[model samples]
Target: MPSILLCPQDTAVFTREYLNGWYSLSAYYASKLTSDLPMLLICPTLFTTIIYIMTSQPDVFARFAMCWGVSLILAIVGHFMGLAFGSTFDLQMAILLVPGLSIPFMIFSGFFIRIHELSAIFRPLCDISFYRYTMEALMQAIYGYDRPDLECHVEFCYFKSPSKLLKELDMLGDLYGHDSGITN
Candidate 1:
């Protein structure tokens, strides 16, 4: 909606007539950012509320904080995507490419496949992937700090600190400390 309404026409008109120069890209970007803010904030906030309630996730505040962060990142990426591909056909191509891009990130997320099992070259991809950070932060938010005790069968009893599990998966829970209180 934003791109369809603002791009290639309004952007040209505003840049040519209003700003006195092409420097209005910032203004254009800001306009899109502001216009989308309400849906961007409301959808994630409401979705987080529903999912957290259903899952009974502890540290609701922290989880909501992380969810909001992820949503904002997504919105920023989406906004840039519109700017990157100004034409409708190009935008459609970018949308088609999203799933292709997501597959590697999903593989490296440590949920679909263990991070340790990934080749050394692929490890860096996991580090860069927002999905990996999102998953790690959510996991740390759920299980960090409190050190919950669980009754486990003999084999599973070896499972200990959530931090240790994070280490085993090569995700640094400490990294998201400020973002979602994943650590102190």
Candidate 2:
């Protein structure tokens, strides 16, 4: 939302400045990215830290780092996507289009529908959804890589075993590296 609102305003000023030969295009772009870097890093780190503790996620530093990294990447991608839309269209149109496009991505993200259960044609959408990859990586970080079985208090626990749960989710393989594009 910040990118969507700010990028257009920045572009207008940038265009005028560039036309007046105030700075090279590359310099302005580089400066803009550099300025935004701190906020990008800080916001995700804060958010990940709070949520990681609040949700009672595993205390392992590596797992927390994985969640934070995935969150940071997602934020960067979302920022760029908003910037693209803001630069390409009017504010109202960009606002409408962003959510409109996101609905399909969310639907295919494997939270509501498993990829294996999806239709063959729609299965490809899951492959492209960043949410799907993020979810997979987070799951793997918290539950995969030979994690022991969860402690179940009830007598009839269906998914006490992390491996069994992953298998049921059709995410039994070690694809953390592939999913997040970072070697695990």
Candidate 3:
């Protein structure tokens, strides 16, 4: 959303500057991207740290790192998506379109419906949905690698077993690398 505002607000200035031969297109793009890098890295790191601590998640460093990494990547992707829409359309249209397009991805993120449960016609959509990959990667980081069972304060905790929860989510596999597009 920040990038969305940036594009519309900067488009006129960029066009004028470019036309006046102040800088080349590549330079302008490079500067814009680099300027956002610090915000991209720092915001996600701080947000992930706060949430990870507040949620009382596992005390494992690897798990925390994975979550933070995924969060940072997601933030960058979302920023670029907004930037694209903002550049392509007017402010109002971009504002409407961002959430309009995001709803489907959210629906197919394996939270509302399992990827396996999705119909064949909609399978392609699930494949393209970053949310699915994000969810899978996060789940793997938090619960996979033979992690131990959760401490259940209540006597009847159904998903104290991470494997069971993963299975129910249709994410019980060595899919962390696949989801993250990184091989071990």
- Over 4 Å off, model 1: 1-23, 59-63, 78-89, 150-173, 178-184
lDDT of 2 by residue, 80-169 (tens): 888899989988998999989988888999889999889999998998898888888878878898887888899999999999998888
The residue-level lDDT of candidate 3 at 141 comes to 91
Q: What CA RMSD would candidate 1 show?
A: 4.7
Alpha-carbon TM-score of each model against the true structure: 0.68, 0.94, 0.95
Worst 10 residues of 3 by lDDT: 175-184
lDDT of 1 by residue, 20-121 (tens): 765556776687678877877787678767777787565557656666675566555655655555544444565565556667777777788887887898
Clashing pairs in 2: none
lDDT over C-alpha atoms for residue 135 of model 1:
74
Best candidate (score: TM-score): 3
Model 3 score (lDDT): 0.91
| Residue pairs whose backbone atoms clash in candidate 3 | none
- Higher-scoring candidate on lDDT, 2 or 3: 3
lDDT of 3 by residue, 1-184 (tens): 8888778879999999999999998999899999999999999999999999998888999999888888988998998998899999999899999999999999988789887887899889888899999999999998998999999999799999999999999888888888877875
Model 3 error, position 159 (Å): 1.0
Please identify which of the two predictions, 1 or 3, would achieve the higher lDDT against the true structure: 3
Model 2, TM vs. native: 0.94
